[model samples]
Target: MDESGSAASVDVVLPCLNERGALPWVLSRLPQGYRAIVADNGSTDGSAELAAELGAMVVREGTRGFGSAAHAGLRAATADYVAFCDCDGSMDPAQLPTLLAPILSGTADLVLGSRQPRRGSWPVHARIANVWLAWRLRRLTGGKITDLGPMRAARREGLVSLRLQDRRSGYPLEMFLAAHRHGWRIAELPITYFPRTGKSKITGTIRGTITALRDMSAQLRSARHLCRGGAAPSVRDTEEEA
Candidate 1:
């Protein structure tokens, strides 16, 4: 619902740290007719202020993980469709149109931008990790989610119904698994995966990579429990039944 008395079209929520340098380029490239929300994770580098200056809704969610900040941004989204992408300029905002089209057309409840490996772009370890995690997700949730982290779009109601609870690095996997369990239609669209310009606080650091792997393993376990316990329907099960 919006002030115009019509359903909001789409809202893009980007979780940002101290990415002021990259924010402008990303913001400038966003498609028309979509509002941007920048969830600041306790950044003191004027990121929030800069987002406000750029006319994006700046929300401060302190002491939160990337997932927590993303959840906050989703909660603040007021559109019929909600999309999220990183602020590191690695993912091009122009790719959003194809990802969002399926949701807008009533074909998919959740849409994930599959991070197609670019030539000489991503590091070798990241590619290996992504493949391993995607396989794990398929084994645990029967969802066949190809990309754990990418620019994603989904219906607001479907996303809200998932009640995504992971507040740490595991959020993206949790979201895909939840959607699977709820019988929500999910689809993947190929997108360019570029190496980010700024420092990657998550992947570039040793500690962060270890934490991410742990969180990913935890998500697989959680997904198994949820699907087997009749608490939710795995995406594959739902699709097959339909």
Candidate 2:
């Protein structure tokens, strides 16, 4: 794995809230040698215990937001490279190595997995919302990336240095925007997206998708406003609810 030798040195952070039903398959499919750190965000469904029993290192994050759980795992990671994957069955951990290829080969500073959703994977409303967000991103940064996805990989130190601030649904988009603002080389690769196990919250539900769209739209507006004013907004410049 890019001179890092064994893949054991890579840590995969799986942020979870209530993914107890999907824990088994998600943890089981992690590629050999990659460590799984499940950051549990108040899962009353026993998700944290289930992940621990499955041999994943579990960290309890009290804050109830995707970014909080994600950031906590990043701090807990002791690996050369880190990957963020959904604990739900939608994303396959096996595809993480593909996302990390650019980082490992020094071809990119940040690599995001552009999901090629199979049937029944992504809902129409969610997909349309993502299209709008991606279009806004292109207008702001003129970058080639078309999808802002959750499955992503990057060197631990460089990602931490981005100082990403959003703790809610906007977290992933904030990471993308920050990388562009800092002139980090960003790349995207296609990954298969499947229907999630159990009840889907953010992407599957209309209310959840609207919540995420509002958060992301705010981030985009702030970025555009700042960029037009001749100043790239710092990570903290956009104040958002975690």
Per residue, candidate 2 scores C-alpha lDDT tens digits across 70-99 of: 989998998989999999999999888888
Residues 144-222 of candidate 1 have per-residue lDDT tens digits of: 6777765899887778878876666777887887787778888888888876767776767786687677676777766
Candidate number with greatest lDDT: 2
Cα-based lDDT for every prediction: 0.78, 0.85
Q: State the displacement of the C-alpha of residue 39, model 1, in Å, after optimal TM-score superposition.
A: 0.6
Steric clash pairs (candidate 1): 180-235, 181-233
CA error at residue 119 for candidate 1, angstroms: 4.5
Error of 2 at 113 (Å): 0.7
Model 2: per-residue Cα lDDT at residue 75 = 89
